[model samples]
Target: MRPSFLSEPVRVRVPATSANLGPGFDTLGLALALYDDVSARVAPAGCHVDVTGQGAGELPTDDGHLVVRAMRATFDLLGGQPTGLAVECVNRIPQARGLGSSSAAIVAGVTLARALVVDGDQRFDDAAVLRLAAELEGHPDNVAPCLLGGFTIAWTAGPQGSDGAGGAGAGGGAGACRLEVAPGVQPTVLVPDERGLTSEARAALPAVVPHADAARNAGRAALLVHALTAAPELLFTATEDRLHQDYRAPGMPATAAVLAGLRAAGVAAVVSGAGPTILALTSIPDEHLPGMGWAAQRLAVDVAGARVDRGRLGHAERDPVAAGRKS
Candidate 1:
């Protein structure tokens, strides 16, 4: 069936995310109040993209843009492509800062595409949306929290239909559980001026870890969930990671230094996602800040996640400087 498109423009607000949360590795994420506002409408001729804030000049303005590619991929899944597209992005999330900026873009694109189509939500559904976005982003950690909000524990469900007779048919897709953060759990991100690649940070990890380290991380990862949800004081002990941080530390000495300093001061801090950015789960004293080269911002937990609405970019959404970004 050829799906109908909506004439009204659609916009989406996607929250920035911090993944790993220490020992949880690729399985945990938290949605921050920081966000990117994006809007799209079907065009008559060619694809046109307008960028306002971050990555305005550096990011692509046409079909090659990450958002556009994601939209195109979604359109393909929905039945057919629109004749043209006009996209406007008022970005606030810092790119390549281990803050789930790319995942936010991908979620916005997927959501905007679905909203642009009539009865799109019915056709695609929320579960399908999460699965597709996770597939596009290559992991559920960031995308899950970006889409569903709150603190999320994400994982890839193995292939289904392995009932001895049917034999695995297809993958079960991405799955996640969202939990409310305790009132005392404050999230502060120390973002660096320089960018760090997720690939490079990942490559620095050793192929295998000792059994004891793995076991210790497992306990801490479980404790992290409890500390984040119910017991805030235990966060300092819960957020310990023996799996990846130390191995990747040499590449990001500044981040390592600050993380160690904050932890020594009894702050529950961890390398947000891959590197360069540090996420402090507990409040940090003024005396412990790294001083310069890092922008520190305390953000609220976004419980609503990605929001889609029937409208173009309004005055507030169009503002390039809003969305809790530190100058």
Candidate 2:
């Protein structure tokens, strides 16, 4: 069936995310105050994309664009054919910086698709969008929080003999649970001039690890949840890891050094996502910001993951604003 075109432009805002807060590996993620804004209007002709801010000159401006591709994928999955789209993207998340830029794009695309479709369709809810985004991104950790907000734990439900196992609209067997992040826990990120590819970072890890190291990481991951919740003081030890970070260290020595310095200073710091960007969880008052810097920004936990507005956006809302800017 043919999909109804939007009468007005649809605006979608998606938050940037940091995965593996510490030792949770591919299971934990949190949405940050950073965001990307995308607006779409149905066109009678062909698809076109206009980008500003990050990756303005390099990212594709056609159907090959990630956001547009995601939208098309969603339409294909829903068994509907949508009209051509003219999309404008104001991107803030840095690309390939281990900061969930790609995940944000996927979430934005799916959200935009949902917004453009006619209302009363039962298949376009949050869970359905999340599952689709995860499938497009090939992992649920980053996309879960990007779609649902707060802290999220994502896992694959896998095949079982149950009636719903691996069924359609079941998120391809993925599951996610959102956790509340305490008010005192502040998140700051250090982004370097250099960038790291997620694929290269994954390639650096060994296929196997010592059982002892795995056990330690598992314990710290559990402790991290508590530390982020009740005991902010224990974050220093809670964010410790015996897995991926160390293996990725060689590729991003400068980031590793910054992480070590932050840890030494008693701030809970770890590689943000894959590498290159370091995330520090601290309880220090706003008066005192972390001193050592490549390019650092203090961000808060985003309670709202992604939102869609049905009408035209105001000037301030449509413009490409700096990340974490006070409104």
Candidate 3:
């Protein structure tokens, strides 16, 4: 007989995330209000994935799906036999647009694995989940915010460090740390119709930067954190960067133009994650930003991060009472 926990499905919702936020560069990230919900159950046989909304038709519907792969990987890490899963994904975050779509999927998979197990067992806590997700995602920047919510400062500590675990198969040893973001900072995103791959954007960066530029960016990154927590008015100067953006500009001229125009207008704006999408830190409302025929939305800082709910049906299959409880 199947265990009681396996009698029903487990559903997880993970928020979209924006990384870098300008000068932080693979270190700073924050969660946005946007979300992707995934529901998974132990299937009788083969794995099946059904995707909706963003990337519905293009994404694979079999075991090759990223969410499924993440789930299997987590099971392996737990020293448990992999189970065939029936997974349904309702994706809201745009793909390959600098937003953390893949990170969200990775988080959802890990969360689902933790949620499906018996409660009394050695549970997969936040720290364990973060370590596993970081290993899967290759970095903690996006996954940390997706798991921890709010703002996150992610770093890999040295071998003697007290926190974090080393990357999968990487020779260097280090522990990962994801610190919570202080309050009062909000983001407004300018999403372009075109998409940009993270790999391509990463390849554009030069191996070495001038020492002066490096030093300046370091100062700005420190100031940016202070500005975000206390004096948001200083955001304009604090969000400056000397790395990654200019090199990625040629592939996203329109996005670069919008970013330049916003900064020139005294708004603190920078390329979100890799390219194409621009994240502007502002107290002003979205309706007030100059409409340049692009999609713009004001996003609240997500405080809840990824979560799981049991004994309830999927969003598409929920009853009114269940929906009310969810709300």
Q: Which predicted model would earn the best TM-score?
A: 1
**For candidate 2, lDDT tens digit of each residue in 66-172?**
99999999888666756678898888888889899999999889888877887614656676777778888988999998988898888766556554645333435
RMSD to the hidden true structure, all candidates: 2.8, 3.0, 4.3
Given candidate 1, what's the lDDT at residue 103?
94
Candidate 3 local lDDT, 1-327, one digit each (tens):
222246578888788899998899988888888878788887777888888778889999997888988887877666573356788887778888888999999988888876776651365556678777877888888998898787777765544433444542132321234444445565888888888888888988999999999999999999987887777878889999998888889888899887888888778899999968899887544444646556777788787889788743456543322232111
> In model 2, which runs have C-alpha deviations exceeding 4 angstroms?
161-172, 283-293, 322-327
Give me the candidate number with maximum lDDT.
1
* Estimated TM-score for each candidate: 0.95, 0.91, 0.87
Cα lDDT of candidate 3 equals 0.77
Candidates ranked, most accurate by lDDT first: 1, 2, 3
- Among residues 3 or more apart in sequence or in different chains, the pairs in candidate 3 whose N, CA or C atoms overlap within 3 Å are 164-175, 164-176
After TM-score superposition, the amount by which residue 258's alpha carbon in candidate 1 deviates from its true location, in angstroms, is 0.9
Off by over 4 Å in 3: 1-5, 119-123, 161-184, 283-293, 311-327
Candidate 2 lands at a TM-score of: 0.91
